[model samples]
Target: MSGDPADEQLVRQAQGGSRAAFDMLVLKYQRRVERLLSRSVRDPADVADLCQETFLAAYRALPGFRGESAFYTWLYRIAVNIAKRHRARQRPLESLEDGEGTFGTDAAPSDDATPEALLANRQLVRGLDEAVQALAEDQRRALLLREVDGLSYDEIADLMDCPPGTVRSRIFRARESLSARLRPLLEGRGGRRW
Candidate 1:
């Protein structure tokens, strides 16, 4: 028997009506889901509420999971969907005088962005691009495939003609490099808030 139970095993146990198994899965993924939600939702309270909702939705849909993808990947999709719905519902209300009011005004910018925020955002994007470009070619490719394209390690390995273990290592190193480059600029500014 395996020394450590895989997520697949926990998923199977959860699907077999084991509440403790499901709780284990929840504990493992809660922080990841919260971080994902934080990217979209600015309010901590709303993030917590949405995190709970995502897990609840996942639990209800657990029986239907077919294992075509990793459980975390499946759970990630559910969390994303929940965050999208929460954002849609929490969209800012428009004034009567604003003739072009629309549901997704958040994306369209109902008002002008402050100069400071705009400059900070632009700098952040530039730094991110520079950091990614600075990575070794293999590391850059692996990071883009896994992060930007959302490809699984196995899929990235097939495309890159490398082993999955190598792909994992490349992505990890790429992230560490980028983080080191970006940390100074992001300090004391509530980095994720932007």
Candidate 2:
């Protein structure tokens, strides 16, 4: 109950046994929660299931939720934990689909852009995706939560259950690893630094 005032009101109502208020909260954050889940869970079906489970857990725990952090931050913790448990139950030998890149390109090429530029953009995006996927789980998660999600190190540390220094170290190592992996692809672009 510590996010937007609207959310706080809704949480309070939900805590007082207002189902509609809780549904409103779900509608507000459903897409964001799904997007977060998609970063870790490859299967859309599984992501949807985990998202439902996240909200369900939240609703059940709403009465005990103190206004210590933002509502989204609290919900994110639940989602992350659910995704981790799901991953743990998955088989290690399961094969992943090729070209299923989770990370997106930095910029989309305009329609007026040259074909060559578009091709280069695609290559860069692919390289980034592969490089990110190659990183250790902790590094990858930390990097995405920082860069893509734009979360503070403190927030990430809370979600990750680590010290802020550890989160910083993980993101640094992730960036270094990605830079090394993508250097060759980027070198062809007039020696631009990644």
Candidate 3:
């Protein structure tokens, strides 16, 4: 068993059909799954239901879960997929006419959003953009390429003419700088740490 008994060992036991082990996994990750779902699900009741569905789906698929990826990574992917499906079922609000022409939905907004909430969101986005802009050129490019462009670290390294390790370091540093700048704005907001 791994030194962290609650992780690998519980997964192994759960795979062997131990209900208690499976229940333990659910208990450990319930809060995290709910928090993740809350990002795309506005209703508290809906978030709770989705969390249950996610765990149920994970349980059914447990037999096929190879040990290739960490258990949490596998579970996280399942939760995100469930949340995406839940969001897709919600009706979209009116389409924007800004040439971009994208549809909006209540799923993307908090259920209790007021004018103040909208302003706070806009301010947060502006603050993040400013933080990104304040980064060094190389760091900014590396971060954006990885995040906004969704490029692999190796791909980013090739484009930036740097080693993959260097790209990773640059991205980490950039995130640290941005996090430092945004910490105060996010403090006491009950947001996820990462």
The top-ranked prediction according to TM-score is 2
Task: Find the 10 residues in a row with the least total lDDT in model 2.
Answer: 92-101
Cα RMSD (angstroms) for every candidate in the order listed: 11.5, 2.9, 11.0
Runs in model 3 deviating more than 4 A are 1-5, 93-194
| Candidate 3 lDDT (Cα, 0 to 1) | 0.74
Better of 1 and 2 by TM-score: 2
The per-model lDDT (C-alpha) reads 0.74, 0.86, 0.74
Model 2 agreement with the true structure over 1-194: per-residue lDDT tens digits: 44589999998899999999999999999998998998878788999999999999999999999978788889998998999899899975322354455765546668798989888888888888878878998998899988888899988887787999999999999999998888898888875656
**Residue-level lDDT for 159 in candidate 2:** 73
Residue 96 lDDT, candidate 3, scale 0-100: 29
Model 2: runs farther than 4 Å from truth? 1-3, 92-98, 104-109, 112-117
Off by over 4 Å in 1: 1-5, 92-194
lDDT of 3 by residue, 1-194 (tens): 31244678888899998999999999988987776566456567998999999999999999998766556667767887897788789885322222111112223677788988777766666567667657896897688767755778976775566799999999999999988998877884665444
